[model samples]
Target: MYTLYYIAGIATIISFVSNKEKTIQGLKVGWKKFSKILGTYLKLLIILSFILLISDQFIINYLGGQAPFVGLILGLIIGSITMMPGFIAYPLAGILVSRGVNYMVVAAFITTLMLVGVATYPVEKEFFGIKATIWRNIAGFLISALIALATGILYGEVLI
Candidate 1:
């Protein structure tokens, strides 16, 4: 769906550039616009990547070498603070798992990261009405708890 939207946007821009009687060529204009947008996103990505790198090292040191419970707490705390897109969250979770973090806790952290965002409450309230947003978040948190429990049980079974 997002890819389709991106393709549609690119097509629209190309058509518009072709129609325009510009001093520069159509391809040049399109490339310039695309490059500007890409550059902006890349800059933001670089900044965020640095923050994540520093944060992971800080968390690992703070939690000690082998502490799954500490990782769970720190992950949840970071998840609550960080508001990057969901796509980034999964890869981060995978990295944490590979580092010997608990899978169930990562699942809970991911759930809470997406579903129980205090930062998004104002925007959600304005769009969906205050009461509706509050109720939905509450329900989402509850479901996230159940998912965490199930994930823990499943993983424990494998360990045993």
Candidate 2:
């Protein structure tokens, strides 16, 4: 983050030196765009944080001692719906696994976390259209489920 800030500062300085008028205009445009979406961004952040908190509690309370299939389904749903960065998701999954969560569940969560993006569907639809985005998400979910199943078998968590 600091590195990014440093790079941005340097770039801003260069921009200002190259063309002060353009730099000011660009900054104004950027600020306007950021401000336009600030409310949406805040809402997303608050909703995501609340969902994550509730989901964690729910998982801790009910996911344990449940069947692997149940865990798989729950994981798929959570992973598909939740929008978290990989850095946060991976570490959180690891911590859950260390706390004795089902390996298959973790596998599904990780796979879908990487492949599926339900929360980003609006953006994806903007780029790829509604049909393509839907199909892509469906394919991603199926593939992630398969990968999770394979992981469970390979890890000896599921017998043939």
Candidate 3:
């Protein structure tokens, strides 16, 4: 992350020197766009923090091998509603697996973690509009479920 900041700083310096006017214009535009979405981003953060606070135990118990279908459903909902980035999501999924959570549930969580984003809907809607965002999320959830089921069947049968 620091390296990325360093690289970006260097690039910005180069761009600014090469064309000061263009660089200034670009920065102004970028800042404007960022400011416009700042409120939405903050709201997302607050909501996610609260959800995580309440969900940790509930998710573990529910997905830790209750009913496979229920686990999958819960996984889909959790994955969709949370905005966990890949770096955190993958390691967390691994921990759940090690703790004996169903593989199907983990798979569903991971799939939707990457594909769906109910929590980020505000940002997505800004770019894609409400109808498109809704459809995309729905499609992503269904596809993630299908992938999870296939993964469970293939891995469970083959490895066992």
Candidate 4:
């Protein structure tokens, strides 16, 4: 993480040296956009944490070995609703798998979390229209489901 910060710092310094005014303007724009995103992301993260903490056992009971398909479905639903960058989402997926969640579930979770945008639907709709947003999400959901199914078959004999 510190390495990434160092690299970004170096890049920023280079950019600033090349064009101070442009670099400053870029930083200002980035900060403004990032601040809004950070607030919403943090709020969603908190809500998700509570949901996970409260339902940990429920998750284990349903999504562990007993009812994996149900677990996968739940994963797709939650993942679609979630809005987080890959850096956070991937680590969360690792933690989930470490906790004994099914591989298929985690696959669906990660895939849909990256591809689907239920939490961003309103924003997307504003830019792309409601119909396009809905279709895009549907496509993402279906693709994630297929990926989960493939993961199950390849990794777990889950579909067998």
Candidate 5:
């Protein structure tokens, strides 16, 4: 982490020395683009925090391997509802696993988070038509479920 910062700083310095004007221009453009997404990222962070907090409690209290099917259902529901970038989703999945979330549940959550598009349905429907978009999402949801089961089998969490 610190190494990345150091490398970036050194590279920036070299870039500035090689072409100060171009470096400044690039930095300005990058900052502008990053700033636009920063607010959205912050909002997602808050939402993820609340979800993890609630889920941690639930997992510790009741979900404990005893109700894997219910946990997987919750995972699928939450993942389908929430739209987030993979950068955030991956880390969130790791945190959930560390918090005692079942591998199958985490797999279902991560798979659906990337594949299913409940939150983006409006935009997809506008471009692809309602029927096509709806069918595609349905197919993707089924595929995600399969992937989750595969992940479980690979992890030795599921038999046969």
Candidate 6:
């Protein structure tokens, strides 16, 4: 939050100094553009956000207390399919950890949360060329899987 505020302040100052009149006009244009985008995505965002919330809580309360290896697999499966933002995963993972879920499983889930987002595929392909984005995302997903597996296993050993 602080970083975002600082960046916004800096950008505003820079624009004001660069050309005050132009900056004011640009700010108006930018707001309109952003508002339009928010309006367009509002429904989809609400639906997806709800789904994420339900899924995370379900996983934490139900699947999280199982054996570490089983929980890891479940976490990976959930992470791959979940469209929730990575930012929300941290607290969810913490909750699962408190519920007796292994840290390694949570780590794997967090890794997948950031690396493999099925929901972002269409936009990612459009922005970054289909083949390039798919390959990169796949590679990232694989690396995240490996990291989660290794870290979870290590954490399980240490904590146990």
On lDDT, the candidate that comes out on top is 3
- lDDT accuracy of residue 53 in candidate 5: 54
In order, the Cα lDDT scores of the candidates are 0.65, 0.82, 0.84, 0.80, 0.76, 0.73
lDDT of 1 by residue, 1-160 (tens): 9999999788867776777555246668778888756654565566556545646555435433435455555555555445567787778777767776677677767887787755566556656888998898788677766676677679882242
Any idea what lDDT model 3 has?
A: 0.84
Off by over 4 Å in 4: 1-66
Please state the error at residue 78 of candidate 3 in Å: 1.8
Report the Cα lDDT for candidate 5: 0.76
Model 6, 38-150: lDDT tens digits are 64366556657665666556777645776767777777777766766556777777787788777777877778777875666655665578898778878877887788777
In candidate 3, what are the lDDT values of residues 57-137, reduced to their tens digit? 566776787677788888888877777668988888888998898888899988998899877887788889999999999
RMSD, one per candidate, in order: 7.9, 2.8, 3.2, 5.2, 6.3, 4.9
lDDT of 5 by residue, 1-160 (tens): 9999999999999999999999999999999988876665666566655555544355334434546778777777767866778997788777777877788888888888898877666556656899998999888888888888888789888889
Q: Which residue pairs show collisions in model 1?
A: none
On a 0 to 1 TM-score scale, where does candidate 5 land against the true structure?
Answer: 0.60
Error of 2 at 82 (Å): 2.2
Considering every candidate listed, which one attains the maximal TM-score? 3
Instruction: Give candidate 1 regions above 4 Å deviation.
Output: 1-54, 58-78, 157-160
lDDT of 1 at 111: 80
Better of 3 and 6 by TM-score: 3
TM-score of 6: 0.64
Positional deviation of 39 in candidate 6, in angstroms? 10
Cα-based RMSD of candidate 4: 5.2
Stretches of candidate 3 exceeding 4 Å from the true structure: 13-20, 54-57, 156-160
